[model samples]
Target chain A: MWRPLAEAARELIDLCVMSDVDEDEVRAARADVEAAVARLRKVRRTQTLGQQHLTGGRRRPWGNPVIGLRNPIAPPLQVSTDPSGRAATEFHCGPAYEGPPGLVHGGVVSLLLDQLLGHAVGAAGRPGMTGTLTIVYRQGTPLGDLRAEAWIDREDGIKTWAKARMIGPDGVTAEAEGVFILPRAIRERSPSSPTGHIG
Target chain B: MWRPLAEAARELIDLCVMSDVDEDEVRAARADVEAAVARLRKVRRTQTLGQQHLTGGRRRPWGNPVIGLRNPIAPPLQVSTDPSGRAATEFHCGPAYEGPPGLVHGGVVSLLLDQLLGHAVGAAGRPGMTGTLTIVYRQGTPLGDLRAEAWIDREDGIKTWAKARMIGPDGVTAEAEGVFILPRAIRERSPSSPTGHIG
Candidate 1:
């Protein structure tokens, strides 16, 4: 039920962005959307924050903008990890994520890599906050299916470094490197663990 | 009309992420969302892509995820520019953008900086594509009112560099440096112009 609703919401956004129907039709659609919103608000939310786990035992990121299955804003990328702790996912971008004409937004590319690198670091049993992320765009990522992957580069003291890249239909379009650091608080608490939980 | 609709959509997403009401209520909400989608689809959209302008003469980014007034996924950031081409905005992030409990998602931070840097470069009359962006997270950005700013650092031939930072209630939460480049195609098209256009 959530999946369908999310998909529907995505389609609505696409329509909102691209639609050029008459103003009357737009008004009608707005009315429908408002009504739907009113109905959804009839219930109260629990307000408890969601939990984030390391990739080794990651849960569904229901509200995540990159991979959350229940988030309409998400491309909802499905990530798969190998035994070696490398992470990868394949997903498609639509007009809703456009920056340049018919191309994926650079921020969207960064968002995908950030999450992928975080997962890769966690899968390797070292979870930490994102200290720094550096991304390079080699070419424009077209709005369509693409493949992305990330892996651990090295670990130095409290920092775990990871690398990632995105491959568009034509070729490699973007690459990224991220530094994940175990906060002082987390390090003190765990003592023995290389790192704590990641975001 | 678009603003209210976008706000309503944002509220709905927050509900979807945080709600823990009865299953019957969830089902009912889903039905309403589905109905809204069905009504929205009654009209076909004009397939023309939207135009993006340089920040020097920027238009409202109605579909942009960072500052688009009509985009629900956007924080709807309202950026103001100084005569020197510095860009700044004050906005709020709600629970819909949470990552680590009460904190703003790291990816969301990247997204905001990416757009801010792009605008800064464009406002400098040297707009280019995001070639590279390096971000350092100094602390967690809490999900609430915050301020972000960006400015041009330097320009070299085909590249324009910019710097930006996000300030939470406590202090600086994150900072970034971006390298924007004028692609060969764009450069060739507007030979005399220092840079053609930006995304």
Candidate 2:
């Protein structure tokens, strides 16, 4: 149901950034866009507000902008879990994500790495919020198909450390390490099982 | 000229992510959007493509997405330079940037910090590409108005080290350090001068 809307929205976003329309044409376009917004507002009035946060471990493929199926900001991600517990996703950065001419935005690369690391932690049964993240850009990430992989490095108490890397067509474009913190509520529920050190 | 276009595009992006219309309404909206896109395409065919990278020493307030004047993804950044050469910008995050329940996306915070540090380095007479960035999230950054400050920590050869912090209404939300690499072209121009250390 949402797939088509997401595709359309993505196209719209791409046009907005890359197009070079003149003022009069842009004004005309704006009027059309305003009309569409009004119609959308009318439909929105009938639905209740959505839950603000993810809950219950129910996978939300469409909840995050980084991997969300219904988010135009997201590059299409195809994720798979390895039997050994690593998480990997194959995706692409198109012209809409352009930063330095042909290169991907540095922030967008960070976002992908953050999501990959978080997903790796969750795949290992220890999902948490990001506490710290460090990234090293080895080379400019070109706007094209790419692959990313992440795995848990280790764990200490309530924190899980994970590492991830993004691979462009040539080679490694960026690498990252992130610290994720398990919330207190979840920590309390799993006490005595093992509070520290995950291999 | 570009201002109004950016404004319109931003509105389009916000509506794309936040709107919750049904399939039929989405289809209708898509038609209107398509018309706008067609018009934009017509205009784009008549103009030359823009320069692919930043050049000269001209300051482009609308260059980077984190603080670009015409970028909807950007928070409105009103920057002021201090007498001591530190750079500061005051801005706000809206619902469109939401990641956690009421908090800003961690990546968004990182983007802001990256820009702040880069801006500070540029303000200090050394601008370059990001080599590395490390961010520590002390607390969840709530979505609303905030302040960010960045300044040069030191310099080594062609590398500039900088630090920045994001302050929310409560207190400090996130802090970061980054290393930026000055290109060889710029480095060669200033080789005769002292190439190490900065207060």
Candidate 3:
């Protein structure tokens, strides 16, 4: 589906080229098609029973594996769930994650935050998935040896909030707040217990 | 693999069925395995093959798509070559990109900036992909109406700097600064052309 659109945008450029359109005019048309392509590229097919693709982005209209990816350079963190919420992990970034020649890409910071925050949520008691996560990138993260710290911030009846920070050798590179949810069924499965009243 | 981890975590939930382990001890141990499971899940086998699964929170490794994009949700911005250094058109984001239920997802904001900045490089008489993009989400972004403005900020031969701002009905939801980089070959491809002056 996106291929034709890509071709159409390309054709529009060809059209502009044929019209002896000045550079400015050609660009105007080109930008229009390009913008549309960008918009269309993001739409996913509806989640029908027969659909092989998932609900959203992974169901990229064109099925282009590369574009379907979120960040192309982030590495997943590995940690041991030491029978308590504590764990340690490390990962390295390759040139693929580089920005400014050697600096780490900022999007990668947010990526790490989600992973760590999810860990924090799981540690807190209610573990499922992130409903929302936000980040503040304070400084440029060096491409190598980045470190992340995460801890449970608070827990509500069914939702748990966590905070996480990513640090590079220079200093803190990013901070995040995340909301991790425990589906209702998971909560119901628990027997009556005299612990922190989840309610 | 992830399923077993989830099941194990669920089984270890300090259920009342296990009276042997002290309540406090069971709780602590359950916390431990859940945390480990969370980290382990980040390494999706699909993702290792370069398939994207998450959006807004984590970005994939570099050379992958923008972060948190488990699937396609936005359209692509098409681009055409130009000697005068200008873009094809403007890109827009609308209701389809809602985050926070009604606001735009932070990752969606970053994705738009990435696309616009990538286009800006071409408009600046250079062609490249986004090496790094940093988006500062100022406030919650309204879902219905939004506009994105991007243009080349500076060009240092193969490296082009671009800036993008996301405008909401009330004000700016976010702004981004990016580095767009042309591969060495692409920068050297048209050294003989009129725009070669940039090289």
Candidate 4:
């Protein structure tokens, strides 16, 4: 049911990212999109904020811009968690994500690291909003199949630290460390909470 | 000219971000987009890489993802340079950029800061690629009008250091420091060059 909608959205994003149409075609396409938006806006007014997950919820994919299966901005990422609770994913970045001539955008690299690190922390039973993130770019990440891995580094009270790296065909292209904070509401609810919600 | 193309692209992105359509509607809209893409692909084959800027080039608007006037992913940013060479921009983050509930996404903040800090370095006559970016999130940045500023902190040989901050309605929301490196090609071309091309 939702798969087709996501696929269509991905097609739309691809067109927007690299399409080169003339003025007449662009105007025509723009009008079509505007009409769709007007119709959709009517439906949105009837819906409310979706559900929030605390812990052990259904293992449904999210709509995150970086790793969400339903997000067109994301590449097709296939993530898995090992028994030891490390999270890893493999995917390919296409021309739509290009920043430099042949390299993936640096911000996109950060986005992937943030999502991977967050997932690693969540798998370790601690999830929170990003408090700080530091990214180091070792080399240009080319647009192609790549691998990423992340794991928990340490945990201190309400903060959890994690590190992740992106590997290109050559070698490590970027690395990151992040501190995620458990919200006050969650902390007040469970003093010894190991699993929490992620933002 | 390019304006209409950019405007159309922005419109397409907006629809992709928030539009809610049923399965049948998605299929119809997807077909429309696919046809447009077929025409646009032909047009793209005729185009080449656009222009590049060295030092003191005309301050023309670019299509950058974070601050480009033609980029829909960007919040509306109005920037100006001060006498001391600081770059400041004021803008608003809408729901389209939300990550956490009622707050702007951390990566969005980093993207804006990266662009702002990069612009500050370029304005100071040392455009280069981002080597490292370290961001500290002081608080959850609420979604609304905000202000950001960046400027050169120091420089050594081929490295330029810059700092930037994002302020929400309350106070400081996030801050960042980055080290940008002038490529060897640029450094070798001008032994003491303060400005180079940005990748």
| Top candidate when judged by lDDT against the true structure | 1
For candidate 3, what is the DockQ-based docking class? incorrect
lDDT of 1 by residue, A80-163 (tens): 875455999998887777776667778888988998998888777677779999999999998878999999999888888999
Docking class of 1: medium
Once fitted onto the true fold, the runs of candidate 1 whose alpha carbons sit more than 4 angstroms away are A46-48, A51-60, A183-197, B46-48, B51-60, B183-197
lDDT of 2 at B87: 83
- Once superposed on the true structure, which residue ranges of model 4 sit more than 4 Å away at CA? A1-6, A45-62, A76-78, A188-197, B1-17, B20-24, B46-63, B68-79, B82-85, B189-197
In order of DockQ, best first, we have 1, 2, 4, 3
Of candidates 2 and 1, the better by TM-score? 1
Chain A TM-score per model, please list them: 0.87, 0.83, 0.55, 0.80
lDDT of each: 0.76, 0.68, 0.44, 0.66
Tell me which residue pairs clash in candidate 4: A125-A194, B125-B194
Question: Which stretch of 10 consecutive residues in model 1 chain B shows the poorest summed lDDT?
Answer: B47-56
User: lDDT by residue for model 1 over B1-199, one digit each (tens)?
Assistant: 6666667677666666765556666676667666656666676544414344333244445777777767777877899876465999999997767766568889889988998998888777777789999999999999889999999998889888999999999999999999998666656765444342356
Q: What TM-score did chain B of candidate 3 earn?
A: 0.53
Comparing 3 and 4 on DockQ, the stronger one: 4
Highest DockQ: give the candidate number. Answer: 1
User: Could you tally the backbone clashes for each prediction?
Assistant: 0, 0, 40, 2
Q: Which of candidates 1 and 4 is the stronger one according to lDDT?
A: 1
Question: Interface RMSDs of all predictions?
Answer: 2.4, 4.5, 22.0, 3.5
DockQ of each: 0.53, 0.39, 0.03, 0.37
Position B94, candidate 2: lDDT: 58
